[model samples]
Target: MSKPLNIIFAGTPDFAAQHLQALINSHHNIVAVYCPPDKPAGRGKKLTACATKQLALANNLVVEQPVNFKATEDQETLANYNADVMVVVAYGLLLPEVILNAPKLGCINVHGSLLPKWRGAAPIQRSLEAGDGQTGVTIMQMDKGLDTGDMILKATCDITPSDTSASLYEKLAALGPEALIDTLSLMATGEHTAEKQDDSLANYAAKLDKAEAELDWSLSANVLDRKVRAYIPWPVAQFTFIDEKQNPQRIRIWQATPLQLAHGKAPGTILTADKKGIVVATGDGALSLTSLQIPGKKPLSVADILNARGHWFTPNTPITGQINE
Candidate 1:
């Protein structure tokens, strides 16, 4: 009978939890699981546990949530796990060398990009925003450099024109566990080889933030369309019309499609509103917003919103949305 490989898992968020679930389902001997400490979130600032921590506890595996594991002595505890292998997903904290070298097979990571591109903190969001043709997961042997690890396995997925961060995230999250399982199976059978990432071709997927989520009217309609999709579920794109004629209402756009207009109206212009949706003019074309959420209101289809609040917006007027200082 084949012996179960003793493993240490590190991760946070729903993405990481998926992999942990995979390991448990596979009958792998996970010695310990590491994740970020509980954080204060939401209006109450209540302390909430990370997704990984919740899973680790439920699975009866040992769990660790250190704020900063950069210290040499602090990392020694992980080295003591005597793990045969370490599998890391979107574990928020960076692992030091001591912990990396703890396992016999070193460590492996499930990164969310094809690699040599979008290789850092926010790969999924950046890929969609850049309008990339394809993106997927790269299971790599963890190295000191950030996501510059050598690839042991890779699987690609198409990025549809309508793909949003939320949709792509779930797709990639499902892939992580499946890809990790594939990598582990090959590694167990001595059929895996690591391919080094090209240093010069890499692009950093810088962390997502509210600052970048503000829709810029000056940019071409195609660009803003991607921005609206990429920023979904986090720092949603917001625009406020300055015209008193319009309600200075804030709306969170959830999805959009680009269209070329024969008439080039100024960007941010309220081109029209109909049963289909609200069409707004842009630098090069226009965007039809299908779904959106008004401030302090539930998200609704554009048609429902226009029918209820038709007076706030008029056809062929500048939207007047501004990023408030």
Candidate 2:
């Protein structure tokens, strides 16, 4: 085996930290760890370190938290690390050309999707929302573009119909670390080859926001089903409806299925509520919401929720936010 290469790791969040943990367990020498600066979080808005920063500190690694590389000192400090390669996973910051070239073997990335497919901030979530049959990880030679890098390794995974964003994220987390280690081994032996991505086949995955989670009942049931699954664990798909008490209420849908049975009820109408699920009318079909959550309460299955608040979801009630004309 070739000598272990000097590596610098840049990442944030739990997904990135998993890859960092893999490198720590390997033979490579991690010269430095770089992540974004701590930001205020929680109700108190107290500054909080990211997952990678916490992990790096626990391992007694040299940690650097730079807001950006525009400062000359920051750039010089990184270059002085003298690293053979830098592994970036969900780093969130755009690297300048100088920073990309500072390392001996250049910077490599553990992207969450197969290149030329879903590429950008929320690959895992976007793939689920698009209802793709399969998605995977791509270890690439990093460049200035947004995930438009030359691929060094590819690891594929199936996207089951029941898979949510959180589940898909876990799947990639498992595949990414192994792929990163393999890519580093090949790089150390000078056996890695780069494959250029076909620019025509790429799709951008824009960052997620709460606004998009508002369920538009006017859309098809299948489309709404995908959105509900993709938005799980963050800004869950929600809809507003007037409750039995005559007050507007927002309900978050955590799990749902598209029912093929046709219905004449207007979109957003509550078609039925039973042990199976809360069936709601949509523009093209019906959706059965299996798991749901009310603000200030834990998520509950449709049966459980109905047992507690059976009067709230009476059939023929119209959900708010859309006109039924």
* Winning model by TM-score: 2
- For each candidate, C-alpha RMSD in Å? 2.4, 1.5
**Could you give candidate 1's per-residue lDDT for residues 1-325 as a string of tens digits?**
2457888899989989998999999957899998888999899999998899998898788987777777766577788888889999998778778777889999999999999799889999999999998999999999888999899999899999888899999999888899998888877766789998888999999999887866877788899988998998898987765545545676788878888875567777788878687888878888888887878888888888888766656777655544224
Give me the displacement of residue 10 in model 1, in angstroms: 0.4
Task: Report the lDDT of model 2 for residue 11.
Answer: 97
Q: lDDT: which candidate is best? A: 2
| Residue pairs with clashing backbones, model 1 | 240-321, 242-320
What lDDT score goes with residue 2 in model 1?
Answer: 41
| lDDT scores in order | 0.84, 0.92
**Residue pairs with clashing backbones, model 2:** none
Residue 172 in model 2: lDDT: 96
Residue 302, candidate 1: alpha-carbon lDDT: 84
lDDT of 2 by residue, 1-325 (tens): 6679999999999999999999999999999999999999999999999999999999999999999999999999999999999999999899999999999999999999988898888999999899899999999999999999899999999999899999999999999999999999999999899999999999999999999999888899989999999998888999876665667778899999998878998888989999799999999899999998887799999999999988778889775633446
